[model samples]
Target: MSDLPPNHHADLRHSGPSGYISGLTMIVGRGNDARLVADLADLQPGDHVLDIGCGPGTAVRNAARAGIRVTGIDPSEPMLREARLLTRLRRPAGEVEWAQAGVEDLPLPDASVRVCWSLASVHHWPDLEAGLTEVRRVMTAGGVFLALERRSPVGATGTASHGWTADQAAAFAHMLTEHGFVSTDVSNHDMGRRKVVVVTGRT
Candidate 1:
């Protein structure tokens, strides 16, 4: 989720081909990002993890492989469908569940998840503050949360429409602190060809 609803840019209905294309792109190009998130999460066996806006369940699959139970949520039906198919194919040791839900409206109960990650999805949230509030509400005490997004280049076309600016990233980190997340940090990293803004914190 970015600054706008996903449907505003791309409608990913299950009957359409765009969702599949997006899923394939994630499978091939976003492996490193997912792995990075998994490593940061340091998931343990039996731990429950949530992947918000889990496009094709790439991160969910990666974390599940580490023996963590995973729940992937997305607003797109096609994306969720693709995620289930991919997870079934991978067959990770831990259980994996997929749900069609937006970041601001999670289906899980409060304090249920031990860890949560949202990659390239924050900007699409209709209400950033509300979404973060929801995130905090669902996470257990001392739970870890990470959010990552591409840092769009300056003067790049559609930059505003795509990713978060440096200042926005900083503000997001501050928001985490205000929401009672400790050890919060916001930094930029060179992720191969592009830079990314990362926000990490613990409840």
Candidate 2:
């Protein structure tokens, strides 16, 4: 875990109209991206998956459709509320639980998760290293971790502040390797209208 200060917690919260905009983005704009993460996770039936920085639970709902149980964790109460509402409306096949938490502080037991997915959310993490450590701690041996973030010049959002460059993606992949993750791969993917940097690692 990183020894850095924790001031980013305030930046993590999504409230007011921005929260609703984020929710709408997850629901309508990022469904394919969520499915890509779910596919990359290679979930097994009854597997317990964790969605860190899960905004509005879009990825949670997507993964649950494959019959894997999911827990969606985020620091934003408004996001969690939207997630719960969406879950009720979608009624995915697998069970989903929502938690008000953050990547630096996962509210789960060690080695409890079979897979972890974080989509378009890593930039908001308070401390990337600490968050990855927490993710590793919560995941079982050989568990998969898939994270996707928009690249700069994002065609859809045009939000560069939360986006990464190719070099940054490579650096993040190296960090994963240093943290004891094996078979780490980082690459850019064309997700229809937008480009994304995808990082996959295993514990």
Candidate 3:
């Protein structure tokens, strides 16, 4: 549906009971992506990680298990509620907190996070530049930044167009650099039955 650029699904939002249920069920398949990003963070005990656009807190819980503190921020209260319920059912080794907010505005202090990541969620950001600025502001100098998105074909349409194409991924990497991130890279990987593209950088 869209090409070359990022955040094609900027207008997409998850709210209400139905949206929360869908996030917990349909989008819950992002477990593989969660693990991929958690491993990418390469965090140590007591490090602070920030998860943007966290849904159902899958990646949040996964990373927190590494004995680090994590803040999972989302725009939907209902989704945060679901995340809290699931987290309570199965606790992680590290501390975990949740906030209801969008990428454009994070509820965090400056240079407070060691690693910041978003899994299969960056494309939904309403304002990619503002989101990246917020991410950079929250991350410490030399902090890792990563984003994972399913690989969508260049001309794909409908649901098949939800993810990033190679060019789009590269574009996002460029944006990261523009936002003062260093060593930005764009790479491809596989996640379960899906192919994914990952953009990485350091703030």
State which candidate has the highest lDDT. 3
Tens digit of per-residue lDDT, candidate 3, span 1-203: 34547898888888887677767673457778888877777877778989998888998888877778999998988888889988999899999999999999999999999899988789889998899989999999879999999899889889888899888898899999899997898888876688998899987
Note the Cα lDDT for every prediction shown. Answer: 0.79, 0.79, 0.86
lDDT of 3 at 167: 85
List of clashing residue pairs for candidate 1: 1-121, 1-123, 1-124, 2-123, 2-124, 3-123
Clashing pairs in 3: none
Model 1 residue 171 distance off true place after TM-score fit, in angstroms: 1.5
Best by TM-score: 3
Q: In candidate 3, which residue ranges exceed 4 Å CA deviation?
A: 1-4
Order the candidates by TM-score, highest first — what do you get? 3, 2, 1
Worst 10 residues of 3 by lDDT: 19-28
Give the TM-score comparing model 2 with the true structure, all chains together.
Answer: 0.88
lDDT of 2: 0.79
Please say which candidate is ahead in TM-score: 2 or 3.
3
lDDT of 2 at 52: 85
As a TM-score, model 1 comes out at 0.87
